[model samples]
Target: MKRLWLIAAICTGAVLLAFAQTQQGSPTPQTFLLRYKGKPGDVSRYKSWFVMRMVGTMPTPAGLREGKMEYQSEATYLHKIISVAEDGTLEIETVKESGKARMGDGERMRDLPDRPYKRVVKMTNRGKVIESREFEDGEEEQESEEEVAEFPIASRRYQPTYWLDKLYETAVHNIAFPEQAIKVGDSWQEKVSEQMTPNCKVPITINSRFKELVKLDGKLCAVIQSEIDAPIDGQDNVGEWTVAVKGRFNALMTIYFDPELGDEVQAIDEARLVLEITLSGPNRPTLTITHRLISRGKTAKLD
Candidate 1:
C-alpha cells in the first residue's frame, strides 16, 4: 500500500508539476510533448490506465469514516496535447483524460484516447491561461428515454487555465519541510535524491527536489515527475481521489527550444516528458509513459 501510494504520488505529481511549469522568470506560451505511464505491481488491477477513485478516511459530523466516498472519476491522458505558442515557444500541457457523465447504473465519462473532445483555451501575453471552455458533443443524445435512461450520461471537463510561472508558484507550496508535508489537506515525507539527465546537453538536470504544488489543472504536481493528485469524490459518507501516473519518467524529458523547432529564447519543447519513472522505496516498480510528437503548428493561437 505504501509503494502503491508512492507510485501514485510520483506520477501524478510529475504531470501536475509539468503542467504547472508556468513560474516566475520562466518561459511563456510554451507547449510540450507529453506521455504518462504507470505500472504498480500489486497496487491495482489497472495496467493500461491510471484510475482515480476514493480511498482513505474522511471527516464527517459523526466521526471519521474508514473509507472515503466517491463522487467523481477521471483519468489522465494516455496521449499528449501539442501546441505552439505565439511567441515561438512550444508548450505542452502534461496531458491527461478527464470527463464525467451520468449513466444508467452509474456515471459514464468520455475520457479515453479514442473519445473526441473540443476545448477552447484563452491565454495572456505572459502565457497565463485566462479561460477554458468545453464543447459538448453528445454521442447518445438521440437515444430513446428507456435506452438513455438505462444509460444516463453527464459530462465533466478538466481544463488548464494558467501560465507556467503561475503554476510554479503553486508548486512551491508542496515543497517538503521537516515538520510534515502539509498545505493542501494532506501530509507526507519521503527520501529525496538528485539525479542528472541522461546526457549533459539537456539544459535541465534531474534532481531529488521532488515536491507537490497546486495548479490550474485542479491538482498538485511535482517538478521532476509528472504526477497528479486530486479530489475525485466527496459526498455524505464516502470520498475518493485520483492519481495520474508519471510523465517524463526516469527524470528524462525532451527539451525543444527555438532554433531547433521554432523561436529560440521564447519557448522550450519537452518531448516524452515523464516517459519513465524509478521506484525504489518499499516497492520496486518502474513505469514508462510512451508518447510521440506527431506534428506541431507554426504559431499557436490562444484566444
Candidate 2:
C-alpha cells in the first residue's frame, strides 16, 4: 500500500507540473485598439502618387468618338498637430507642398503646376473628421462666373484648389477604422459621403477587415484590407455643361498601419469606375466613361 501511494503521489505531481507548464506557455490573445496619438507640435509627412486612366466613347451626330486620357501626379502632404484636447480630439493643420501633374496623350500636357494649399481640420481620435476648412492657395484667383463657365471639365477637375480639396476629402473619408478593440479577423463598416459637385452627392460604403498582425520594415504593423463601393447620384453643372453620372464604383485597398506610431506605414489602392454621363448644353450628347485609378503612398515622421 505504501508503494502504491508513493506512485500515485508522483503521478499527481507530474500532472500538476505539466499543467503549470502548459499554462505558462500559452499566450493570451492580442487585442488592438487604433487611435491617433499625436501631441501638440508633432508633425508627419507623406509622399503620395497617383495615376489615372480614362477612356470614353461619345455618340455624336457624325458617329462615335472615342478618346483616351491619362494623368499622373505626385504630391507631399504635411500634417502638424496644433492641439490635442483632453478627450483625444485633435486640431491639425495640413499643408500640401509643391506638386506636378502630367496629363494627355503621350504625356504632352506635362509640367502642370500644383499650387501649394493649406487647411485646418479638427478630428477625433477614432479618425473622424469633425470640421475642415476650404483649402487656400496662394495662386488661386477668384474666378468670375463667366470665366468658370468657359473652363473645360478637365480644367475644372484639375484646378489646384479643387485637387487639394479632393485629396483632403479622400484622406478624411479613408479613415474608416474600428472604434472598439479588435482582434485579427475582426471586420467593420464605415459610411462616407462626398459632394462630387455642387449639386451631386456620392455615398460610399467601406468594408474593412483586420487581416493579420505582421512585422513590416522591422516594425510591428497591422495589415488591413478594405473594399469600397460608391454610387453617384444627382446632377451637377461642370464647366459649361450640365452633367449627371450613373455608375458603379469599386475599389480594393490594403494598408499597413503601425499602432504604436499611430500612422499608416504604407498603403495601396486600386479602383475601377464605369460611368454613364448625360451631358446637356450647346451641342453635347450622352457619353460613357470608364476609368481606372491606382494610388500608392508612404508616410514618415517629419524630423
lDDT of 1 by residue, 179-238 (tens): 222222232333222222111111222222222232323322322222212211111111
lDDT of each: 0.23, 0.58
Q: Cα deviation of 84 in candidate 2 (Å)?
A: 0.6
Winning candidate number (lDDT): 2
Task: Give the C-alpha miss distance for residue 235 in model 1, angstroms.
Answer: 16
How many pairs in model 2 have backbone atoms within 3 A of each other, for residues 3 or more apart or on separate chains, i.e. clashes?
0
Per-residue lDDT of model 2, residues 135-202, tens digit only: 55444465565554564344454232232235334533455556677778999887777776677667
What number of clashing residue pairs does each candidate have, in the order they appear?
Answer: 62, 0
Name the lDDT value of residue 102 in candidate 1.
22
- Candidate 1 stretches with Cα past 4 Å from truth are 1-53, 56-64, 68-115, 138-259, 263-303
